[model samples]
Target: MKINLAALQIASVLALGGCTVLPPQPAPAPRGGTATPAPKPQLPAPPPRPAPPQPQAPRADAANWRDLPQTPGSWTYSAESSGSAVRFGQPGAGPLLAIRCDRTRPAIIVQRAGFGTGTVPATITTSSTLRRLTATPTASAAQNAAVAFEITFAVRDPLLDAIAFSRGRFMLEMGGAQTLVLPVWSEVGRVIEDCR
Candidate 1:
């Protein structure tokens, strides 16, 4: 019986040794050979960037008063209890030039809007006459104006008539301001006539 048992154990051991377990092997690569690493899981492309903005050029400044274009405005008149005024500019804008009358003193005040200090010479040139006058810093008279030079004329001054009756137009000039080529309009005559 002992011999039979020992023979049985030996047979079991031989069977187990012949049927030993082994890890599973991978399948052989395809015939194409250069196994393309399974196209790495494709990802979406990033968005494109925008172009940079361009810079703008600066505008050129006018060298002198004559380089400026002629102002396309006309004279307008208004009356107040203190006096009457004839202004030269656009209807809704401030006047570039103004002739104000003071009823109490009975004088004509000619003002030109500009920038300067102290007294300077102002000229008004007509076809027949050219009058040069001193324009002092007269900011008090021109309320709401930035800076102005003004000259006073008596109501009977002949310069008023020359300005009113000049041939078609007249020119006003100052040292540091644009020249104004103003038309000889009836408004100027009316102001003169009313002041007198």
Candidate 2:
């Protein structure tokens, strides 16, 4: 009546192997309704990112109140013949620029010492104004007081007044020549008044 233990264990294992196991299933939906899905576990949200930087306007420089692009150099201004003519230059050098009054013609003649061929445009810049005028080569070096070019303006030209009353200084740009930044002085106003 005694049974083999090994054989009995093997028979029980073979019997259980034939059966299948599965996870629990969800219930069917009711008539005319959809089945809802199972809920999922929730997770915490991540930290927020920083905002981008905004553009800012430029700040004013107190040290350079004038806001000049280039610093001007020291110059000397002299009026000759009671403002009939004015010259601007270094104290010890010949005149770099001159403005003369032609009383007979009632015109103002501006002259610069530079070498250029033919006629060219001269650009004048002041704090609040800019003007471009035609400059013709002087007919004779000796006749123009050794100047190479000249710009003639009517006695009542507004540019004359602008140069006289310019802020601190005015700039003169000639083609193929060095630019000159001349200081505004009493001589400039005097010449304008005399010409007018």
In model 1, state the lDDT of residue 151: 85
TM-score of each: 0.60, 0.56
Against the reference, the lDDT scores of all candidates come to 0.78, 0.72
Off by over 4 Å in 1: 1-70, 140-145
lDDT of 1 by residue, 47-119 (tens): 8878886863211212232334456898889997878999999878888899888888989988987766667
The RMSD (Cα, Å) of candidate 1 is: 20.7
Backbone N/Cα/C clashes per model: 0, 0
Name the runs in model 2 displaced over 4 angstroms: 1-83, 140-147
Per-residue C-alpha lDDT of model 2 across residues 1-196, encoded as one tens digit per residue: 1468888888999899877687788898878988888888888898898898786422121223235443243434444554478776656776778888878777889888665556877888777677777788886444324446888999888888888888887777776456776778887778778867
What lDDT is obtained when candidate 2 is compared to the true structure?
A: 0.72
